[model samples]
Target: MSHAPTGARRREIWLLVATFLVAVAGLIYELIAATLSSYLLGDSVRQFSLVIGVFLSAMGVGAYLSRFVGEALRGFIWAQILLGILGGFLAPVVFYAYAWTGAVELPLFGLLIAVGILSGMEIPLIARVLKEIGAPEFRFENVLSVDYVGALAASVAFPLLIVPQLGLMSASLVFGALNLAVAGLSLWLFRSDATRSQWGVWALALLLTGAGLVQSERLVTVAEAALYEDDIILSETTPYQQITVTRFRDRVRLFLDHSIQFDSFDEYRYHEMLVHPAMSHASRRADVLILGGGDGMAAREVLRWADVAQVTLVDLDPRVTGLFQSHDDLAALNDNALRDPRVRVLNQDAWQFVEHANTQFDVVIVDLPDPKNLALSKLYSRAFYSLLMERLSPRGVMVTQAGSPFYARQAFWSVVQTVAAARNPVQVGAGPWTLPYHTYVPSFGDWGFVMAAPFAPKTGDLAVPPGLQYLTPAIWQQSHVFGADTGPIEADVNRLQSHALVGYYLDGWAKWFE
Candidate 1:
């Protein structure tokens, strides 16, 4: 029943389409800024909150400034062009800023404000253009609805498709090109409204974005090399995190989201100290459970024991396990432990796996990262420890890698106290006796671990494992002694409700690093 659209009607439809495209582009830029800041800097909560706050406030500034524009069509086109250029190169710019200057706060926030202001001007100018074309009175409402829908589309696509498929740097460039394309389409639709100079500017911006897209990989490599001292032999942006491996001569290092996990030169000290203590303490070592050791280093130490029949390793990221399992150099580092017949690797969330687990282990080793954020904080909570205790055999022993005893004193003791506080309802009495210990590794100074069990773990006359790079009988006994400065302080029990551990960990590390 619908008739062919008139010239004015067609112009209004095109303006609405431009409105949708602009909305999508704007939201994508905001997400990219927030995500990139979080990756470069730790404490994701703080980075995301500040970036969103600054961007939104600047958007308000842009909306207020839009009232001064006399020519709606020209203003909208200019905003689109500027936003495309700024947002297109945002990731690389921020990355280089962090690499070269060793700080990113100034440039990151400056570009965020500029892009927000331009995005804020877009919808208002589009509405004005729709009115100028003699569209319906309800056209403003239609513009708002379309804008909202486009925003939803962007939010869903960002994590599911954009980040995983194209990555942050390439995604930004792609969305930027889409923004410029919208401007070009508007110019062609209303050819009389745009000048020859406007077309020329648009063409130049498009060319620049295309060139950046073609060289995105090289740009990432150069920026990453500047950040690290060693040569970056492997780098991949997985769905979960950025996994980078660097090598200097014979020494190799693994970094997850810019945080150094381990340095090959001194990694033996960390791994031997982590695995052997609990393995020797456990009454039975036949069935061992490791929560987070995807690199296979922990499994290598576990396999050192002759009595251990099966070692079950559960890690969240498949890319990490696959790398250790397949890569020649990485696999050799773990002695190909992950490919052994006795070891079973399951890629699943540690908390979820323990909650659903029905098997009881003779020894449980939790090798998770520090609880700097809410997601990681829960893994160290009293609730998680309680679930883990239920999975431990009566004579079983459990040990977790606490933070640095010297730098994060309270955080280290918090894990020790939290483990002592966990009460397994099925087990009798009020004790999950804890043993706190620390050893000095040159790569990471004064690292700590906490061992807990239904009964007191045997700390004396331990059977030390042979062929160990570190952790001798004398060093193992000495690790239990803490100096005055590194000794425990009063720390609140870490629970899910308050997440006290995250606050303690962040505040402790911030004092030293910031």
Candidate 2:
């Protein structure tokens, strides 16, 4: 039944190998574009959702254009070459474009469409080449299946191998060369095609460029120097998060997406705001729970109160706590906070930890991040508040960093409402001044807090820990009122999964680069 000969089988195997490379190129380009966007932008889920939407739409447009593809082999060769050039340079183009283009997005949508169309058209062209060379009709589905298998390989390899090993720039270039290799193979297989010589030049350029980048790893760091102002002291991409520690002498800073988690110089303001108020208001305080201060700033604050018999701090990232434990500069910031004798550090997601908390606290301080996406927003959800309520002793106080009451006003109140609805007496508070720290970061400004309880305080007249540089009675008093910086807006519709901060962050921050 099969018309194809053994010699043809050998030739077809080589062509399939070429198709495998093409598939790898397409997938890496798709994932790299999505990955870079997720890295630069704060929310991975939102960035990836938009990227997949745009890419799929563009791929549909591309597939429709395949009907007009007349010179099949020539067009396919040119496509591979172009993909090599464009995909290889995409990372740098975006990085530099962020600095150069004062406004208007890097036409990432347009690039997505261009690359997606080209990528979508790849399989059809491969099938056409195979059919022209006397391959049996039964082989069509098998060829397509092989193409998808290669794509799966690329997907598994990109995040796990390529990215961590090569980083953005080098990885792009290496994958670009892979595209060029596909072009060269296409030329060898289909030498009669008009695009052969052009493919040669593209292949040479891609190989040389990729090999050059392999040697210039240090230059890559130097190039990244422009994006960050301070010296790049520590940079790592952990499974949970990207952590960057930078320093300007005593002013070491930990940044999660351009948002300051802590600055060695002045984090006392943030920690004091997060911990002391709730602890001071606690009724006969003895036990304490801190939800998310992996850097151990709040733990240091909690340990100061002599009545606190045990302080349990739950944070998601071990690397964060590890740094506070091991990194010299980090330990100095919190004054060896996590190492303190009374503290028990549980490195786990507070969302999961609170579910299993058998022990209640006199004071529960929620030092969670602002709800940027669904995963984070749920921590601000009514369900999570119910858990918090379960973990608080009767007549105890819980406080949280409710974000900027001005910029994310409704987002801040959403936390309060979620808590209030959870059968807790949610007492709201406000204060605004992180100054130039949060000012440059999107539309973010004017930070605040929320205090909630099942009943009134038992230790309302408690003493302050001696080392506090901020969180005085006056600052605590000012932190309670909602004065203009943008009064509360649309609290009810601020769903956790839908994530209101997504809109606010994009709008407010998108202006700065422009």
Candidate 3:
């Protein structure tokens, strides 16, 4: 009849706090699982297939097992114990298993299922625990609200707090320890549910697994290193995406989504072909818009003209832009192009930037990576070209890094055809000079760009700029020559699944590797 004492009221608040903690642990498990999958498998398709497959399979099993759980909170306690043990070890185990067995897809799928199934039991079990502890008036909606709020907190912290500070390996253990804390809370609150001996063994298991995972950071790094053949010089994971640089002897390669963007070793071969032909014809007037060469090497070339008033570059990655802006070694490579007061670096995606530009340029250099997949394919699409064409001044030329004429013939022409389809009647050309270094994984070869404009592009000798070590007229001249073996093949530029071009890219790489 009377209100409960203050001590009794405090106990209910603690139970609600316990509910929040367990919900957070479950979400942390999902995030780490999904993130690792995305890293190991490139974004386009591998991650979705693996993560979704595992979660759905595990959900089915969780639903199946839920029917068998006993009346006591003991089942829920045991579930957290199992979840903590599995999820704690999940990151390091998945990484090492993939490296050892070479069946990345297998464990990648398996662990996701395990985490998902365990996570599914959490809500029902926690609700059951609250009810058994004499909190029957706690409405379903109230408990659900607590669960959902806890999820929101976990979502915010996992990326900003967990990943950046703790990193993937340590973060997994930290979350595992958090899950153990929830289990420990249940043990203290409900000693009557399980025997003392059983609780002791479960606690030992949880402690051993959590402590064991503390050393997991070393294994994850070693496993990742084993995945790549080259020496990984730098790897950064931004909230947006992954940026990796790998070096093999003389070659320093930049990779985004496991697709090679440029080899510092052979970038000149690609950049010279991309710039010189248009640079000479377009240089006389001096207006330039470069889309997506965040490395600044292209800016190094575009800024050479004394007549050029301004060079505006649009790249999506701020870190890349900032690196060249401040990092001394990189600045030297790009001739400090980002610092050139004449050059303006706009940190934005090329697609959105090109679509919305109000002004036109004497030259629009579309320096985006190849459209090996749909995300990049959009940049090469007819719609994107139309926007680009809209922003080109008369006599203004825009060049794209067309797949490859040698192997990705269809893909190379699809760029040509799409530009043609893009209402610009674009003229296409090929240079096979960069074919020697095609084993960069997921992509192949330094290639060509379709030169699209309102009129035929003027062909002339390359004018070597001062302060340059790589570009010359002779290299420019030879860039146009395609040999008999690696010359044009029947292909079309990629359009969604008409990935006739991706096939060509893959084929070119296969031959180059062979």
The TM-score of predicted model 2 comes to 0.85
TM-score of each: 0.95, 0.85, 0.82
lDDT of 1: 0.90
Arranged by TM-score with the best first, the candidates are: 1, 2, 3
RMSD of each: 1.9, 4.9, 4.9
lDDT, ranked from best to worst: 1, 2, 3
Of candidates 3 and 1, the better by TM-score: 1
**What tens digits encode model 1's per-residue C-alpha lDDT throughout 349-447?**
999999999999999999987887778889999999998899999889999999898989999999999999998544666859889999999888999
Task: Compare candidates 1 and 2 on TM-score and give the better one.
Answer: 1
Give the per-residue lDDT of model 2 (tens digit) for 186-241. 67756666554686677577776676566546545564566667887887655456
Give per-residue lDDT, candidate 2, residue 250: 63
lDDT of 3 by residue, 1-514 (tens): 8776554345456667867887788778777777777665544454555575667578668757766788637776777777777787787777787666755666656666777887777667666666666774777678779888998999999767777667666777777777777777767766656668658867797768656665565565586687667888776666545677777776677776445777776676667667656666663547799989999978877777677888999988898888778978667768899999999999987888877788989888888876544566778776777778778776777777776666565566556666665654233342111111111112354465667666655555666667555556666556656667545555454454454544555555556543
The runs of at least 3 residues in candidate 3 whose Cα sits more than 4 Å from the true structure, single-residue gaps closed, are 1-19, 97-102, 156-162, 195-217, 228-233, 246-253, 257-260, 283-285, 404-409, 425-446, 466-478, 481-514
Report, for every candidate in turn, its global Cα lDDT versus the true structure. 0.90, 0.71, 0.69
